[model samples]
Target: MLPEKTDTVVVGGGQAGLAMSEHLGNCGIPHVVLERARVAERWRSERWDSLVANGPAWHDRFPSMAFADTAPDAFATKHSVASYFEDFARQIDAPVHCGTEVRKVRRVEGGTGFRVETSKGTIEAQNIVAATGPFQKPVIPPVLPELAGLTQMHSSAYRNPDQLAPGAVLVVGAGSSGTQIASELQRAGRRVYLSVGPHDRPPRSYRGRDFCWWLGVLGKWESKTPPVGKAHVTIAVSGANGGETVDFRRLAAAGITLVGRTQGYDNGVLRFNADLVANIAAGDANYLSLLQEADDYALREGLDLPAESAAHVIPSDPGCLTDPILSLDLAEAGITTVIWATGFAQDFSWLQVDTFGPDGKPQHDCGVATAPGVYFIGLPWLSMRGSAFIWGVWVDARHVAQHIAARHSQATG
Candidate 1:
């Protein structure tokens, strides 16, 4: 049964929600976290078996608990990440209602607070903190609505190469997920075809230190300046296989066929626009911009940083750059599996608040939601670029909890 009322109701048990709960408890605030599944369920079920965190273990710590026993250089696997969150919830004694899925969060009668309807029961709260995470839903394009007699799945549903049938595979969207999946398939001796797009290609490690270290030292991680809407695409950083870079060039070298960006389907044939070279060049430009910013910061701060490394440009390959592939017959190429690595879409269908903007994102000055008594955490560029990451959730979570506490004081005072 639900409590009569709580000071705050956190609607997730992932990194963001757990961190928020920790801070609320620290302040002696009465709150509860409602989770649809066990803590870190996405890491346990949605992710692939061999998937690893994009950053190192050192960067994945919660404020109350650090992975002191684990090596800082180690990249946490899917299982390890899930275990870490479970242990965190237990160690902190987090009040999480697992297996309780929230169906709707509408304002209570008279606008006093919120009524959170869940599978178990209805919960009333003076404030709500939506920490449902950024990756809400997997996005599949409209082109392949029905692929006859072919197996198609999003990267979130994909497990391993052995699950696919014996045939060539086409992986769409050359972001981190697409590239990584394609690389894995090629390594397993499967013919892989990767569609390219405009993406950031930053090196995993640079100049004897991880790229994240430089970001921290250069004040990139702490900056609260949010990007102008979703137009800004984040670089797909990877710490897979001991911090190796995963880009189109790397995949191409590993014998993965590189094609242009997928446009649409035309009469049972896959269509690709001729923008491969342009997309690759744009990615290289973004990589250079990041390096340049870091170099300028080092110089301005009089830091003893190493000289900038030479750029790793994609070699001119006729098959990838010059030759244009307008269309392809799936049956002719013997392509049996198509993996959609096209990223995720957010769904706030249960939230009955009017604080969202035209982009369907919560319009808030930092974590404070436009709707009074409601807050948010784990949003990209919410307080900073790192706000959505593991360690980065601490600041936003603490801020939201403090906001709730101050409001409670005013209400009771």
Candidate 2:
């Protein structure tokens, strides 16, 4: 049931694609949204059962609709988030062809427009917006050897502790997902070991405000990319326990064993980098630096905010840092499961467009690609640091839609 032609074709059905469709409709541009599965398929299927929005409901939503009957500061469950996107798509009347996968997108012959092949049918469009979100492919580092009988899966594939083997669990990457999974397993009476990595330790709430609110009010959301040679670190904050800070010390105190970054797998043993203490210190530094910034901002603005406690600024050393474990035998430790909460990577192999950079990411000025009529949306930091999240996707969608509208106008006029 695919259309033979359209003014544009959006290549996703998530927040970014739906937002793009809404804007395209606003500008009287005819387009259809192509989704491989139901709307918000990843949110509906890929996330863990207990997963909740990392940001509160009010901040992590599109401008068109608010999460119904949900508190502004409350984190919506994964199911609720998927329903929200489904409801948004319905309200916007987006022409989304769910269960229709886009197999390939390439420039049509004669150097004009593009031809898109899909699971349903073929469609030709004047412009195509690659609104595929950031978490397209799970990235599990090859730090561990292929051990027989070990239950290994990415965070996306993880559901609950009961699904894991009845043994100790090793969760790699101490980002929000890793920490949350480790905590869940430990609470379920399974010994858990969490692999620490370079991550930002932002408090869930700082100075009587959510960290997200601080990012917005302090103009941090409008921050640009980091300078050359600076890698963006993952923020280690959680929305679980009704939105609380992810303190490694507290996690260790709760009986989750902390380990350094996974180095590699050797003869019947796992190796770790001897950087556990350094990692903890770096995370503490990040936390304290954010606190200082918030305090300075409040002071300059003459705003009466709650003062953070000394204990909150200074972190206590955990026992694992003092006595780091550089190697472990999985069999000896009774560890039978390994959940990789590392992260995701972008896959653009089907996008046969010369718009990608040396890093294999789409090269665009804002959302407009270097190749004519080829646009990209929803990738992390596509235009700004905030572009990685929900609200930011909407903003980027609008910008890309405007560009497409202008181009369409020029072509028709």
Candidate 3:
């Protein structure tokens, strides 16, 4: 029975939600941001202690506050990023009602806006921004669900290698999270198995220089995209196809075994695609060439190259005549743990809003949904290549904010 009137009600107070909140405030738009947990709850509850962003530290900055420069160049951990987000909310005086869970947000008749119901109160806004973002849910594939015998955990739950059950581990998905976690588990004296697959454009440099340096130069650390253009350049950070860099040079140097692509798991046995690595490597030369092209483009444009980012090396595992279904019987093999770094999926069920597309994502072009007065921010590529990276969301945010202002003018007119 709480108050039920506001210009806008933004659900979820994560990076995107907060960014939008700040922009709306600046535009003199009266709005409230409702967060189920405290601000950036996912970052506080989910991120790991040793988690250094794969990108760079500069991109972590937000629109309101400059990412302070104590450890500016390095990948700050979850806590560091979370603290920054908290400070950002305070700086903007964002009307973020913490602990308020949005149970439902239904678009009112005429699609003019939504009726937002939160835990503490209810609100009706002519415009609603689904800034909740896409990282709350953990995507555990059905294939691995049946393997109850093996002690399993997702990347989100992993804090340190200690959380793992024990013994040799089968790590699925080679994205940044998977690769970093596997490296840690291996160092902890566990037989680590890395399952590889396809991934998106692995940017060698952040902008014109090393990716890290480019974060500062291109300001991608805090840029935002609207939606349409962002998806085109930046790929989902999810550990799909295989974001795990073949950097076989490092794995070979570390003596890590390249396992088959995981297809599924039954009882305790794991199934793997035998030729995933070979197939990926064959095409990897092409991806590397693309990176080289990007590098040349940067040099031509006089962009600053990232000096701190590692020089990625392609794997040496060559010639897959016809190998497939590589299985490792963990129990017989004495391996006890299985870490599923297998990417993530978006969960909008709690939203209760009928604004999603066929893919269950907010249906928007360049951050503007057909539902009018509604928008999206901080998606992987809401605008351009760097949209979702730490700095990328900034660019997307500004554009979305501008659209909101224009819509506001029309509404109040």
Cα lDDT computed for each candidate against the true fold: 0.84, 0.88, 0.66
Cα lDDT of model 2 by residue, 194-269, tens digit:
9998888888998789999988887778877853533557778899879988889889999999999999887768
Total clashing pairs in model 2: 0
For model 3, the stretches where C-alpha displacement exceeds 4 angstroms are: 1-3, 109-112, 145-148, 200-208, 212-246, 279-283, 298-315, 318-325, 352-354
Model 1 agreement with the true structure over 1-413: per-residue lDDT tens digits: 56968989999999999999899998888999999999999999998878988888888787567664568888888888888999999998999999999999999988699999999999899999989998999988877757356788999999999999999999998777788788889999999888887777776776566788878987778877744542555466677777786567667777888888888876668889888888878787767777777777777888776774564344556565667577888889889999999889878888899999999988888889899988989988888878998988988888888888899889989
How far off is residue 170 in model 2, in Å?
Answer: 0.5
RMSD of each: 2.0, 1.3, 5.0
Among these predicted structures, which one has the highest lDDT? 2
Between candidates 1 and 2, the TM-score winner? 2
Model 2's TM-score against the true structure: 0.97
TM-score of each: 0.94, 0.97, 0.83
The TM-score measured for candidate 3 stands at 0.83
